[model samples]
Target chain A: MKISEKLARETLLEMQRRMLRIRLFDERASKMVKRGYIPGTVHTSIGQEAQVVGACMALKSGDHMTGNHRSHGHPIGMGSPLGPLMAELVGKATGVCKGKGGSLHLADYAVGSLGESGITGSSIPIAVGAGLSAQVLGEDRVALTFFGDGTANQGVLYESMNLASAYKLPVIFLCENNFYALSTPSHTVTGGRIVDRAAGFGMPGVRVDDGQDVMAVYDAVAEAVDRARRGEGPSLVEVMTYRFREHSEGLRINVDYRNSEEKQFWTARDPIVLFREALIAAGIATAAEMDAIEAEIAQEVEDCASFALESPDPEPSVAFEHLFTDAYDLEDVL
Target chain B: MSVMTYIGAIGAAQQEAMSADPRVIIIGEDVEANVYGTTGGGKQRAEQGDFVQQFGKNRIRNTPISEEAIVGTAIGAAMTGLRPIVDLSYSSFLYMAMDQFVNQAAKNRYMFGGQSSIPVVFRSAMFYGLNTGAHHSDRPYPMFMNVPGLKIMAPASAYDAKGLLRSAIDSDDPVLTFEAVPLWGAKEEVPDEEYRIPFGVARTRREGCDVTVVGVSGSLPLALQAAEDMAARGVSCEVIDPRTLVPLDTGTIVRSVLKTGRLVIAEPAHRTCGAAAEIAAVVADKAQHALVAPIKRVCALNMQVPFSPALEAQIYPTRERIVAAIEAVCADQLNAENRRVG
Candidate 1:
């Protein structure tokens, strides 16, 4: 069945709600990073909220997903609560990963967000593994991983694609191509087209050009996820999106790599605003309903940030914890 | 009792692990064809059936020459549910997937605050003495030993190969087995019954009193030969084989050093930051007052392994080198000032 045929009004509104959650959460995270609350650096999916929510909301809660460094919006899109994620960014004991992974390596397995990697293409194959697990265990679950246009150049992506295809594993390789990779234009480094490379691996490839349309991305990914659950093998979905903020927050590279015209073009196509307009026009939600959703998410982000700030820091003994499954005492080993 | 070669024993252990647990699977380059001969291709092939014939294609899988995906797939499968044994044909090729092996597999459990344990086995062989050139002839276990989230096993004999491989497969965390190509054909009597050698426990190959000789992985035979030669003369030597490097059995070595009052560490890897260097540091730190003479190390010369047979021979630590290091450390009158005066 087509996603549009069975798409409920509640589901459409939920999609926009998730997009709003990502928007306000990432915006709050940006302010907190500038205020020296979040340590190191944070890569936000601020402008790419539609690309994150559309693909994430297409799957069931039990289906697995992995992401790259720009992964704050992924778990929120998958319906994870904001408190643990915000606490993770603040390196508190209440964090999803207990203050060990920080922003770059957040993993909330409770929601089947396997983990996220700081490496560009490292987590792609891990999603393939999850797909392999689903196939081996005879489960109807599928696994999806989100990477970037820059990570598309990584050799591991092709390796993982080929492995998933050859084994007919239920996996989806989602490339969130936001045009730039840390100030370097992706086209400068990338070859012909990422979606076209799927032909070499004998898998179906779909290019979602208007990734700003939440329904468009959701339709494409839902089809692939359906095919994967049917044991029809993997597919590649490259969503054309753009980042509104810099590649990472709080770090100054001081390069005018992105021209003002192109910046204005993508910024004008804000995914949240576009989705909000689409929902209201289609009569799925009212202007007042969208406003209430936005207000609710804004309040949610504030409460999550406050909870993160008030959460206690992990004890020093935690440094030696979680290194192994069995007993390991640093004092005895030393 | 059954006599088996080192490679055969490793295959046997994997076969047993696969039969015992349905979750265990093998995936790598040409694994279905048994290209490297470490995973499977044994007499049991006809008896219990081969990998593909027994468990079918899903359990025993073959992949393209993609080391990164091979390891990453193993990590992912291990994290979710299955126990995957990934064979990256050679230790040198492991460098191609170090990001997955080190960054993903080794750091996954720790970085995720122990949310999941990665029960994956990564098998790679060091084909040094076979003259596979610089790219293929790498003893890279020392490099992985430095990584904290991994369990490393370097088995020197057929018995050890079978037992350690079993233990590695049973381990919850990610484990790496670095097999030596030269020892693949070495045949020895292995127990037909199941057995497992615990990690962090040293095996005494030879016992003596004058000097303690620590052999690592592929250097065990050389240490044994050197100890025999030393015994022919008047020097008594004790040889300790540290089966696992990460959880190194420092207590055994420190006790041996305290008794013998002299130490010598031999390893096939490079001298700098090698397993021998770590073992030497442990002994020096633990039994400093018990030492009658300074510790000496017999290690490969710090350089890229050359292709030429003669040059490669000169770089590796030989039996003669081990004997010489033992003799120097166990000298009758070992005072540095007295030796300089003489």
Candidate 2:
């Protein structure tokens, strides 16, 4: 696959911009949490930016995606506005879910980011349904669902995989193996190799070892998405990534979950640093241009924080609103 | 009007909904084989005539023994654009898919700020008259009613079974339709023409001025029979059937209680925290001024449904129990009146 100079440059810059935005957004969100601007904890996607950007970049705008709890980067990768995402984190009325769903339940349907679930691996079945809908309605759209290696143990994930295979629904199951299911090692909790389980469902399974390399992640996800859209059913792609921070925002720093040497190894392979080096080596962009892009993303993330801070808290009287779609009078039940 | 069995009415409702809308699909265990007979089992029941041949194997899918996947898939499909009708076979099996049913499907609309609506109908056969024992026979509508976003319907008659199901399938919210397994063979006049019974509306089966008796699902017929028996003894009894439990028609029940000045709630579920308790509370809160006697509840004993036929019969509400409750309320009223006159 020969990539045109212009297309490759644009793709590389866009991926870098998305990774920068996620990194900066999480940095700002962590500060906001400390200052009490954000109400609940956020599961930041600090080190797994390339996985989110690569898989989401390969998808078209009309294609669907279901994200996990540690999914602050997904909406950005899917082209959702940063203001609404930030406002939602602060529990403001201007938030995407009107302050109802916090960081974990972020959703932006405009960019085909269907929704993210607080439940682990729950979105897999939902993505299958979306894929099934496309097949039933005779649309050419595909659905991509992102979950952690911890979700590999969820029974519903296997059920969704079997159903997707049986019905030949257009779906890509991307497992972001971050090696931890909240302080527990994935290998200790998971029975076998996560990618090998896809073979049991009779679907093609691939593993991208260098998740920091955006091109590798993109190439693997692009192939899987293509196979799905071509009516070849579902495929599983396991992106071996790592998270730089704690599982949640307010967790103790020295939780003895992973050793200091292991953290140092992943920190050295930072996705943004590696991608920045790749782009400069390939003459896609100069070091000065990359620095300028980072500065611009930092300002954009600051603007999102300001917008969220200025947004008002939701009125308490309307707490019971949006419980149902129909005109159900609460007075009747009372 | 066409005479149809309760099971046949359910099949007719699904077939009619499927024929009318292309998006409506049925996913269940052994739907193609019709093994459980709820989807007009075994093909001899005229309601499910040529379903597999007409709709093909794609729409009428047979799932593996995965209840969680069955409901989760339907919720997903419904969240997208497909209107799915998922059959969980037995109401007791709902325990298996509690996470999907209670957490995911019921809370998705509210938790997502109403951005998503699950137009899925979880159909399950309920009740224990057939001696299916404890595991197969529990009526779990009260458990579902505890959830906010779920609409629960337990149709008592063939006509209501067909009509309410059409409405449930057409509804944009998640609906759990509990078809009484004992009433599957019960025959009644169901309209051949397409019709829908809206939720939260109570049907006044028999009008009377002396006392009010409320029935739900399988208990409606028992209440009506007890009403007939009470009428022979000159105690006129009004019977009300709340078709949908979540969107309960408290107005109808309250008004009937105000008119009759006596209330007796009859249900097959256990006595504690059951549908009867909810109705009794509504009447006590809203129409307590008109009460001539204490509200009586003719409900099943607070014990597990026994496997033995005789024990199950003793445990559940009977026409005799309903009659006895009505007589007690009437007698209590008479004693109060006598005390006031003295």
Candidate 3:
């Protein structure tokens, strides 16, 4: 049975909503950091939200996902509480990682948002292992890894791709090629097209127009996910996107390398606008309904921000806790 | 009782653990059949009905030439409830997978606020004598010893190798199981029944009222060999092996030093920030009042280990060097030193 057009459109719109939530949360928090509201560098996925959401929708409820440092969308897309995610950005106690891990270090284990790694491509092997776990555990679950163009160059990425392919592991390595990797362009760092390298590992790979349409990314993800379920192998999908903001809260992205007009081009192809336009065209959701959805999300973010602020800071004694498993006999340490 | 070389002892332990526990899995480059380049050919020697023979392709996996993924997968699998004894063809290759070892495996459980247990054993052949060159021969013990959550085990003889490997296999935390190149060929008689050499236990090889000698990993045998030579001159020496590094057996070594008053630290790695320096500091900190003389440390120079046999032999901390250091510390004195137990 084919997926209904209305369902696809709604999914696409939901994807846009998750993406926008991450963008605005990071955008506001980044301003806060500059104004002495927060302390710490922020790696925001401002321009690449659509791919994360589109790919996340391709996964089932129990399916797993891993992310790179620039992953605030992983938990939200995987069905985590948006308030905690936003609160985490605001450095509140109610944050997803309890404010311990900021933008770069978010994890929602309940939703199987496995983790995000600060180290480039480190999560590839972990995601492969998670996929292997799903297979071994007979869960028929899939694991998705969202890394940047820079992480694609890492040896672990190739290793992960090869191993996942060899065992036919239910793993998908999605490379969000948003041009510059922390000021270094993808072309300058990677030897060739990111997916071209993935091909060397015998896995099917493709270059998708990430900013063109959410439907484009969703279609690619669905096929790749079906292939994984069929026990075929892994796929490296290089989604070409852009970073509208700086690499972190402090650094500037639109500079000598990329034209400012490129930002305007991506914004014009904005995923929310694309999905909203598609929904309107399909007569699935009206303009007023979409406005209501946006208001609901905004209100949700606001409530969560307040809840996070009210939660007490983790006590200092909590630091000594969780050093080891309960099996650790530290009666002597005291 | 089966007689095997030190390297063979580790192989037997791996084989036994795999046979007893179906959950135990092996994944590394060329681990399936004819696992070439181990001190001995483990793949060729695998017995019938063994893990490699019985489980065949699915359970016992041989991966592509990727250490980072091999370790990372093992760590992941281990966390998800599987005992994975992953291999890094050589210790030098460990540098390629530092993130998995140090960041993921070492700190994962603690960083997760103790919500998980990383029960993985990372087995790698370490040290150099076959002239495999600098990249292959260099001993980076400092890297492993400094990692907070890692338990490092370097077995010297076949007896310790079998016992320590068994202990490491059963351990809940991650263990860095390293076998030195020189001791891989050293054979000994090991008991057939299962036995365990607990972590943080220091075993004495020789006892004396003269000087306390401490060596770790494969360096213990070298210290014992030097002690044997010192026995010729009627200079009694105490030799101790602190089996595990992270949860160091400071009690045993401290008592020995207090009894002997003089201490000698012999380590295969360089002199800088080594097991020797850590041990010396512990002795000075804990038993400084008992010291009759300053501690003497015998180790390789600060330079990298070269490939050439001559240069390699010159750079390594040798039994002769230990003897020379012992001579300097003893300084022709029947003199006041303590008697420690073997």
Top candidate, metric lDDT: 1
What tens digits encode model 2's per-residue C-alpha lDDT throughout A215-326? 8889899999999989999999999999999999998855698998999999999999998887888777899999999999999999999999999998985578877778
Each prediction's interface RMSD? 0.7, 1.3, 2.2
Across A22-110, the per-residue lDDT of candidate 1 in tens digits comes to 88888888998999999878999988998999999899978999999998998888998999999999999999889999889989898
Candidates 2 and 3: which is better by TM-score?
A: 2
Q: Looking at the true structure's interface, with contacts defined as alpha carbon pairs within 8 Å between chains A and B, what fraction does model 1 recover?
A: 0.78
Report the lDDT of model 1 for residue B35.
79
**How high is the lDDT of residue A285 in model 2?**
86
lDDT of 1 by residue, B56-161 (tens): 8888888888888988988998989999998887889899888998889888888888898999999988898887799999998989888888888998999999
Off by over 4 Å in 2: A1-7, B38-49, B333-342
* Candidate 3 lDDT by residue in tens digits, A119-202: 878777888887777666566788899988887778788788888988989888898888877777778866767778866888
Number of the candidate with higher TM-score, 1 or 3: 1
The stretch of ten residues in a row with the least summed lDDT in candidate 3 chain B is: B333-342
How well does candidate 3 score on lDDT at residue B208?
87
In TM-score terms, which candidate is top?
1
| Consecutive 10-residue window with the lowest summed lDDT within model 3 chain A | A325-334
- Candidate 3 runs further than 4 Å off: A1-17, A86-95, A135-139, A188-192, A210-212, A252-256, A317-334, B36-50, B231-235, B308-311, B335-342
Backbone clashes for every candidate come to 0, 1, 2
